[model samples]
Target: MKTQLEELQTQLTKAKQYGTDQETLNKNLLRILKERANAERGIIPKKQHHGYIILCSQQLIKKDNIKYSEAVTAWKTQIQTPYPLNLKSSEIKDQIFKDFVEKNIFIEMEICTDSLDIKTECEVNLQQYLFRANTRTGYWEIELYTTGEITIPLNMQQPKKNATGSCSTFQKDSIKSNVR
Candidate 1:
């Protein structure tokens, strides 16, 4: 989850840097990610995910698959005997990922960036685990990892309106662009 958000943000950054339209792409992707995370936490109804990457937005965040290969390789180097973790698409709502949090052993951390100017950072917590190496060997290995949704500090949800019921955050021109 953390990795996905990072990739999204990195794509957003590159799009903006190259004078592409980041407005449309960013919000849609954020909302999609937000909803998926909410469903996983049981805050929203879970739907059958068809393994299909959300279509249409592909051109918006198109990335060179090899661009981050080096970083990912470096990250995986620290792991040994990489067996499949107990994670599965069907288990999104399971609290297996929250064990450390519920036990208060792992501290939750948040790194937020202001979205007003299209700058954003996300929550990340690196955890270290001691796993038994190769069920046959009486040895252990250490693995560092993080899982769960990336926290967006700036609320993309509509802001609370005053008694008069008028929104102040978005302007007509801004709304027009997003309509596209």
Candidate 2:
């Protein structure tokens, strides 16, 4: 039984690599089982067979989640295109929230600073919840499971505007020109 289980595990791994879809994998597994023993009489023990399937399913789920998270992170990092600050900000925020949802990390609270600097603190019930950011300098703080806290500082230079381009000055100038 142990040898059979090991052989089945090897076959399942190969089947996963070769099969393009779940139906194909299932058909291949069924064919292997039928070849091993006559299905008319009976096959492997139900409990043992189910245990193998369950273990394989768990492994596949973990692999898929990791791949998905990596893809999302990559996509999130490329949001700064097309020369518009407001649009980029919205896109970045949306991507962050989406990734958080996909990884099942609940956001307890979020705070955005007025000066384009964001400071956020979050708590996750599970220890596996890891928060990451592409911009190393983005202002953020994370506290995980009562262990410790992480602070990320952002590099934000103050906006530079010509003194003559001030809104108040523009309005005064417009009024003065109208009076003249």
Task: Mark the regions of model 1 whose C-alpha exceeds 4 Å error after superposition.
Answer: 1-95, 108-133, 137-180
Candidate 1 lDDT, 11-96, residue by residue in tens: 99997876656656754553565455434333323232211111011001113333564322111001211122333323332232
> Top model by lDDT, which number?
1
Evaluate model 2: give its lDDT. Answer: 0.27
For candidate 2, the TM-score is: 0.16
**RMSD after CA superposition, every candidate:** 25.3, 25.7
Q: What lDDT score belongs to each candidate, Candidate 1 first? A: 0.29, 0.27
- Report, for all candidates in order, the number of backbone clashes: 0, 1
How many backbone clashes are present in model 2? 1
lDDT of 1 at 7: 100
Q: Quick one: best TM-score, which candidate?
A: 1
Residue-level lDDT tens digits of model 2 in 1-180 = 999999999999988877668767754664454343222212234222211100000000122335364421110001111112222444335444443354222322121222222355433122322232313323221212221222211211111330111112111111121112
